[model samples]
Target chain A: MKARVFIRLKSEVLDPQGQAIESALKNLNENNIKNIRQGKLIEMDIEAKNVEEAKKSIENITVKLLANTVIEDYKIEIE
Target chain B: MKARVFIRLKSEVLDPQGQAIESALKNLNENNIKNIRQGKLIEMDIEAKNVEEAKKSIENITVKLLANTVIEDYKIEIE
Candidate 1:
């Protein structure tokens, strides 16, 4: 099975990197863009028997290693 | 409108950061995971007339700034 994990900073956290990108875009004339935020996407193959198993394992992996629960949130998808 | 841009390295490119993560996972007893890859996800609001226009603008921004065309590919989604 293939899994994808999307990890993003919590809504209340300040993202300096995202702000930097927003400013850069503004300089490039992308005035219509707003509230720019950046996140991480991790794709991996898992040796699981079914979608449920893959999702469960990926969720565990995400909570333990992929995301910092204190400041970030994560979602997992299995295919 | 809201937009998301996913930027990933080309298949042929090597991802050392992903490799490091994979090894770390192995050390942490996640032996079932393999072929790990990492990418970027950008989320933002777009002041466009419609989804089509938002997607088009995002594509342009992705190609010009978010992704390195020579080594990465990007997908844009507008909602």
Candidate 2:
């Protein structure tokens, strides 16, 4: 089974990296850019017997290892 | 307007960070994990008058500034 996890920073958290990218874009004449927030996308392939099992494993992995729950939120999609 | 960009490394590329994370997951007893690949998601808010303009600007930004076209592929979604 294949699973994808999209990890994003909480709205309240300050993203310096995003700000840095935003500044870089502005310097490149992308003046229409307003705000930029950066996150992570993790793609995993697991040896599972079924889709339900895969989803469960992915959810646990996402919460425990993939994302910093304190400041980031993650969504899981299984295929 | 809001746009999201998903940047992923090409399959031929070796991702050391993904390997490191995979090792960490194994140490945590995630034995079912087979393979892991990591990527980036960039969320941007731009000052565009229409969806077509937003999509065009996002595509340009993605190609020129967000992704290194040599070894990475990026997909853009505008809303």
Candidate 3:
């Protein structure tokens, strides 16, 4: 199975990197931009018994290793 | 308007960061994992006259500033 995990900072969390990117974009003349949030996308192939199992494993993997749950949230898509 | 841009390394590009993450996952006992490609997702709100203009501007921004087109590719979703 193939899984894609999108990990993003929680709304309340401060994202310095995002801010830096926003400023960079503005300098690049993207002056109309706002609320620029940056995140991570992880694409992985996994061996799983079934879709349900894959989902469970992916949830665990994301929560435990892929994202910092205190500040980040992750969503998984499996195929 | 809102836009989400996904930036990823081209298939032929070597990603040391992805390799390190894969090894780390293996160390964490995620033995079933493979092809662990890591990418970036940027979400932004933009003031645009129309969707067509937004798309064109985003294309230019991505190619010129957001992604290293020599080794990476980017896709944009506008809403």
Candidate 4:
């Protein structure tokens, strides 16, 4: 199975990278966007025996390393 | 309209962040993943007059600042 992980900054935290990009857009004279936020997406292909095992493995991946618990939240999709 | 920009490292380049995460997963004893790649996703809400204008605006953003053409490729999705 393949798992896709989307980890995004928590709502309460400041996204400096996104802000910098927005400022660069302003400098480029493109003032059409009202807002933008940036985050990370991780795609993984696992050689698990079954879907349940794949899900369980990815759950541990997210909790341990893929997603930072302090400043981010994650969503996992299986295919 | 909402435009999502997904910028990812070019396939030729090594993704150190992804490698580190995968190794960390191995250390955590979850050994089912075959491969992983990480990238950035930027979500933008634009209040443009029309779709074409919004697209043009984002194209400029991507070409000029959002994506580094040398080592990354980007995909734009509008909603």
lDDT of each: 0.90, 0.89, 0.89, 0.84
Candidate 2 has a TM-score of 0.92
Q: Residue by residue across B1-79, what tens digits does model 4's lDDT show? A: 9898888899898998888888887788767786688999888888788888888888788888888999999888888
Every model: iRMSD: 0.6, 1.3, 1.0, 1.2
Arranged by DockQ with the best first, the candidates are 1, 3, 4, 2
Superior candidate under TM-score, 1 versus 3: 1
Give the Cα error of residue A71 in candidate 1, in Å: 0.5
In candidate 2, the second chain superimposes onto the true chain B with a TM-score of 0.91
Flag regions of model 1 displaced more than 4 Å. Answer: none
User: Tens digits of per-residue lDDT for model 1 on A1-79?
Assistant: 8889999999999999899889999878999999999999999999988888888888888888889999999999887
Each model's TM-score?
Answer: 0.97, 0.92, 0.93, 0.89
- Candidate 3 Cα misplacement greater than 4 A, ranges: none
Give RMSD to native, each candidate. 0.9, 1.4, 1.3, 1.7
Q: Per-residue alpha-carbon lDDT of model 2 for B1-79, expressed as tens digits?
A: 8889999999999998899889988878988886788999999888888988888888887888889999999988887
lDDT (tens digit, per residue) of candidate 3 on B4-79: 9999999899888779888888777888889989999988888899999888888888887789999998999999
lDDT of 1 at A76: 90
Q: Report how closely model 4 matches the true complex, as a DockQ value.
A: 0.82
**In model 4 chain A, which range of ten residues has the least summed lDDT?**
A27-36
Task: Kindly state the fnat score of candidate 2.
Answer: 0.90
